[model samples]
Target: MRDSKLIYYRSGCHSANFTTWLIMDVIVQDVNPAISDLPCYWNRETSKSVGLQSTRKLSCLWNGVDVYLPFNFIKNYFEIFGAFSLNHGVKEFDVSHSNSRVLTPSSRYNPREEFMHFASFDVEGRSRVLCVSAGEGVPLSTQWNPQGYFYPTQIAQFALAHYSVHSQAQHRENIKRYTIQLEQEDTAARVRDEDTNSLVIQFKNTLEFALSSPHLVLSLDLKINSDIKTWFKVQLLAEEEGELFTLLYTQSGIYIQSDGSEFQFGFGNKASGRWLRLTRDLFTDLKKGLTHSNDKKKAKKLKRTKLKVISLKFYGSGNVANISLSDGEDLRMFLDGANWFLENQDENGGWPSNVIFNQGQKKYPKAAEIQPGWYGAMCQGQAISVLSRAYHVTRDQKYLTAAEAALGPFQKPVAEGGVKTVFLDRYDWYEEYPTNPSTFILNGFMYSLIGLYDLQNISPDNVIVQLLFKRGMRSLLALLPFYDAGSATFYDLRHFTMQTAPKIARWDYHTTHINQLLLLATIQNSTVLSETAERWRGYMVGKRAPHN
Candidate 1:
């Protein structure tokens, strides 16, 4: 038998109940010639060939010539060469005596699509055979088997190469199937599945891009699926060397990270039935690893990590119908919002006191009766600060003009447009809205001062605005002595006549107040204000020395 071929032989036992016979054929060559010398055996009572132990070499007369056959080959023909055949090219092999059928070797396998072929044979004695081919152009099977010894490293290398090729092909197909358009930026890919009505917009190399360009915006357009309020699951998928990271967006603007960590933000409120715009500065924060961990050094290292965005999936009962990609709004969103405030400003150069929600009338009957146009000092001050920022960013004269106009209210008395005040000789400062009998809200006063200061920074030539800002700062400093000296933190609201009120203080108000004081210190170059800011900072961070 040739090394690449196989053969089998069998005969039935001469028993009345067992009349069936089985035979198999195999041919093997290029093997050790010593295999021909083993013994063979037969079972006389059963009339079946069994062992290969005989010293005699069986002679077969073929075309009048005697042929010597190996006893080992005859005895264990199936085991040794069966494995050899399997290793060579066969994908499958089976043997049967009663149900054997012949299969012709034709082009049963298409070369373009099919990667394998199979064949079956039925010889005499009701024997059936099966063989498989690994298809055209495939390398001669080098698979290791017990019958044949081969280099394990060689086999492993071949298997790995095959797998790598297969994996690359699969990756290409996946990209083709999911990709809808590669836009001009080349950084983003828009993918849509029409059948599922789903869309995925992916930003390629998200971590790298975000780290270098922290100002870049990431935006998504969410078209509501229904009128009934529901929370749609928004998912961000990212991968690095096959390691996956996921972030889930929940209704309350909470982001649940892949490692079970969570962070919250107010990017936008989730609502139904209208096209909602979602924007986040958190992507840059995420790339920096600031949201994932508290260690600044580790977070900074993570900024350089290579991570690719796999997809962004918005899933609800209804699938994401469409997705579009853009470079995002960044600070421009703030600019636009400030412009909205500018557009909605009252003719008297102020924004409405508060936004009224008629929908709240369902729960509160007088919700609709709430007045809509009574502007407060805090509101006008903040509006001035926003306009100043807008003007700084865009260099738009319109923002500056609007800001100057908004300052009109603070120039006059409360009976007019300005906030009412009373001068305190002890503090050498003016108290705001002195006509009111209630406690003085620190946020309302401090925030208004911040806005005025910010506006003054931009309009240094305006003497009236500068004077008003200095007066407000003096009042703020005078009020500072009433706060606890040890903490350098004030109560939520302070009494006008009385020296003390509730000791309650919120971190939000504390931080905002400290920041405003720092801004004032920077603008005025005042050592006193700077020292005060440093003291408050030390207090907030628990690093302050024992108060003297």
Candidate 2:
């Protein structure tokens, strides 16, 4: 089986599964280039011998030998060794690894488009199948071109060569207990009872809680009489900082306000004479408040160790009881998200988005757009990642099974009710939004790849997953250069459909791209990935690529 010539191609028939492999002798023409321009990481001799120029064409020796690609081929192999195949008298082959059928190339894909580039291909039968591309060509140098511009294909090639295989890190153990202590700050205040279960305070009295982890839940019950005309307030003080939050129960209403910090949230009126049970996730509330505070200093400080709640000072008159603090609510939320995937996944192994998306149609009049009930590659991939972690934590076969099942829609085509589309009839791409014209979203595709990595780690022997992951990786490597826009990254390749200005990612999405690239860099050990991440990071601080 190893000796047989194997070429995986997609038929023009959109409903055909990606299972067809034609046994053909592929003879690719060698295009030699100067070694001085090769990426710094490439061995010059190796680059020279391979003729690693990005403008080679292929000559196919089409033999009708029908040899199927076993999933194990993907398991043992990890590099592709060919210059991209062009229009060589054959129907465009859909090499997308999943058994899923793929959408027909949208009319947007111009096969005869003028701008054509190619990557190197091996003439010997022992080609790098894992490092394959369809028609996309990576740049020779990993560095920016003379115009300070780089392309996705270059970054993709860099990742394909260096990407490492490793499992996702185990989740950190959740902290179990947190202790609270009491302190009387103002002598003007008096406590009627010393017991934690029952306390009546006047003026200012303080309660201090030790903090180990940030996933904190704070709950307390308080009662105030009509005599509290001024207000009964619990001032939450952090250990290192000034007062953090003010929990106030007034005759008018209940309010959560930041003191030295700058956020305020109000809840409607609570009757004075009744006991009020107040429960809050302090970490979430504090994080949200601080983030919206729009004060960078406070926001930066929030990243530091969450200060122990040093004091909860009481003002005016109030009775306190059943005060409690607990840790590990964050993990609870994480598990909750995973459970949602388990419960909500469709029979087709996809999580469906019921809402309609018209953003492309609304923004770009030229875009072939909008649809309801689309399944996103990002959702599938991220859910799998979450479920993989959940499986690790609980050792639940169900979570693993659900994750495995989620690969279903990936095998089908967008035209045949799937979340995948082939770019230019060659590169495999999982669509975030399955629009009429493909929107090759950068962040979503990367996230889907990350999820594949996680699933592959737990179920290492799953052949289907192996092919899906490696093929997706190969496609991503070849496709990277297209996402690069010199100064910033495009949110998606919608410009191909819209024919409008490229949609530059917002600062937040730009940061997400940087973070995702950094992770991929660590996975691939690719200098190109790391450099691109760093360069994108610099953009947030006003850096821009020099225009041609």
Candidate 3:
């Protein structure tokens, strides 16, 4: 596919799926005036020519190709060819090797969109296909424009190029058919057949024990154009007595039977051959033995909680956050991501890569100078979360100690770190305002306190936690006077809305409003919360014009 598209196998297989790819044969240039006036290569010393590249997308060439061994084509190929994303920062990579699909929004995704039942496929009887991803274009010269961009490429051997299943209709059925609406209390996912994905559910505790209290409901009209069937699979096993499944059809539809059950049916676990006691007991006993063994990490005595902390906010609207939204599980995701970013943290503690997609749109143009990075503060907030959780759960001083290390780089002298300077323009055009920061830079500082709050929750000896707490308080207090209290919006300063564009990317306002909201609701600091929110009232509101 020339544009963004997923290439999963309709044949139902995991290894059998891969998105349509674009391949480029790149040749790095020499002494090209870099985009935004930044250096062209990762290092000026390395005489390499890196430029834009393309992939082949023809279908017939892959008639006989099999899985040639999995290779890190990036280091082996792109690095040799000098292809990389210079949209903002010069992160190195083989352009051909790095292909990614933007994940669909939750409202239009599978499970409700499709059953997500597609599993690994058996390919013994299946055939193999490969797309070379070569597009159309021809180069006439050696030098590129001042922006350091490359000309479009031509498919030289397209008729003879390695091709795969080709179709101009690559995005033919890409239209989404339904959307997911949240439940009334916002506890469950519901799908509206006629509505734009009307998905909702309410999980109030049922006084009954034998049956599950959280019943799945389907209330909607399905607008089917042609022949189609809807199916649902639910399993509540082991200690749970009953499992329920429902299929609601808008039309008088024929039901496909697997076990010959009629249109409406339900099933429960049967003891006839559920499991032999010996076998069940054998696995259970083995699991118990393995718990304390050297193999196990934390013994997982309490299941280590697969369910993590979830905030019950109104999806997309970002309106008033429900104060009661929480899942009591440790959010290890914030931790894992934080640790990964920290591990890759540039000396500035900020990740300098721009995430190009906006709202629901996707656009691509390479040159590190254009894409802005907000990773530093995002990672910082995430680090604080992880450190707090690790310390809270285990009372391990090491985790707190590790958390301390997370902010060290950000605190390093700004005169030396690249983070202190956010580029205003290529010729150094416009003047940058004081609060105009790279988004994640400020967020890192703000979230450190959040992580500390998490840590303070369970620490009995809370001394170190107290120290971090005080440090956070002082830093936050210092920020109050710096806030543009009169402004009513938040936005990234790097983006060029019209010179007359409204202020929406208010970086500090976003961080500050959220911080105030957290403190007011979470810490019960209602007095300060009112003060902060009062100033930010214009920024944090419904889709209304900025009321000065």
lDDT of each: 0.42, 0.52, 0.28
TM-score on alpha carbons, each prediction:
0.39, 0.46, 0.29
Tens-digit per-residue lDDT, 1-548, candidate 2: 12233343211112333223333333222222211111112134444567785332222222233222322232224122233444777533233211211122222311111000111211111111111110111112212222111222222222222111012122124444454444534443335644344444433333333333443555555555446443333334565665566444345432334455534444233425665555444544555445444454654566325454433444555556555566523343344345556766788998776544555467555645555456778778767776776677679899899989989878887887787899889878888777777778888888788778788888888888888888888887777778777766789887886565789876557766776666666556457776777776666544678877
Top TM-score hit: 2
The reply for model 3, stretches above 4 Å from the true place, is 1-375, 396-398, 413-415, 418-445, 452-487, 492-502, 505-529, 538-548
Better of 2 and 3 by TM-score: 2
lDDT-based ranking:
2, 1, 3
Please list the Cα RMSD from the true structure of every candidate, rounded to 1 decimal place: 35.2, 22.4, 26.8
Clashes of each: 23, 27, 51
lDDT of 1 by residue, 1-548 (tens): 53433333333334664332333433343334443432223323234344444333342212122223333454454222233325457533343211212122233212112111111101100101011001110111112221112121122122222222223344335321121233445554455634345654433223112112222234444444444333332223333334434434434432222243333222223434344454432344344223334444533444322543444433442223233323333233444346455666677786543322223453223223223344456666756666776677578899888878877667655545455353443322222322232235565676567667667778878786788777777777766655544654664343434334445455445655565555556456557766776676666543545745
